[model samples]
Target: MKKFLQKYSEFMRGRYGVDDLFYFLMISTLILGLFPNFLLKNGLGLIRWLLFGFGIFRYLSKNFTARSKENAWFMKVFRPVKKEIKFLYTRIRNIKTYRYRRCPKCHQQLRLPVRKGKHTVVCPSCRHEFEVNIRF
Candidate 1:
């Protein structure tokens, strides 16, 4: 086992092992795998296989510069979407404790404690006062 791993590491020395785009492709393939019946019925069964093949190609390719550029571009495009998903997940987890509201004056998002009633609120960014009603 040790000798095999050593040989494998040496073999992979100059190859692109993995990156963001590869992970994205692999995840997309897995998600598509969940609906095998739909994919086969639609004649799209090869889509996941193609994605997996491309991911493997990217992983084993010797072109480091191209792979790095593709990974960088993927990260640049995915960062905002990742952030929004994280924000939404956190908000859902803390739904009972906090409420998110946008300030009317500056349009800034504010996290306010959950309270029921009509109350006056102040926007910290623009220092604008407004009334907010929390029903739940």
Candidate 2:
């Protein structure tokens, strides 16, 4: 077991091995695999296999620089979507206690306590004061 582990580590020494893009490909492949055949035709199966193959290729590739660039590009493309999903989750979790609002001047998101009626709110980012009517 110890010899096998050492050999595996040596084999993977210069490989690109496991990254966000690899995980994304693997997870997408799994999700596609879970889809019913009736819902999605045979084309998705081909795509799933391709994704899985690509993910494995990435994991074992010796071209570290190329793999890093690909992962960087993937992250750049995915960052905004990830941020929005996190923001949505946070908003849902704090739905009862906080109300999320965007500051008009700076367009910054503000988390305000759940207070009913009209009130004056100040933007911490731009130091802009605005009146808000929270009728909940």
Per candidate, the number of residue pairs that clash is 0, 0
Clashes of 2: 0
Inter-residue clash pairs, candidate 2: none
Where model 2 places Cα greater than 4 Å from the true spot, the runs are 129-136
**lDDT per residue (tens digit) for residues 69-117 in model 1:** 9899989999999999999998999999998899998999999999999
- Global Cα lDDT for candidate 1: 0.94
Q: What is the lDDT of residue 113 in candidate 2?
A: 96
- Residue 56, model 1: lDDT of 98
Model 2 lDDT tens row, 1-136: 9999999999999898999999999999888867859436655567778889999999999999999999999999999999999999999999999999999999999999999988899998899999888888
The local distance difference test score of each candidate is 0.94, 0.91
As for candidate 1, its clashing pairs are none
Q: Please give the lDDT score at residue 130 for candidate 1.
A: 98
Q: How well does candidate 2 score on lDDT at residue 66?
A: 96
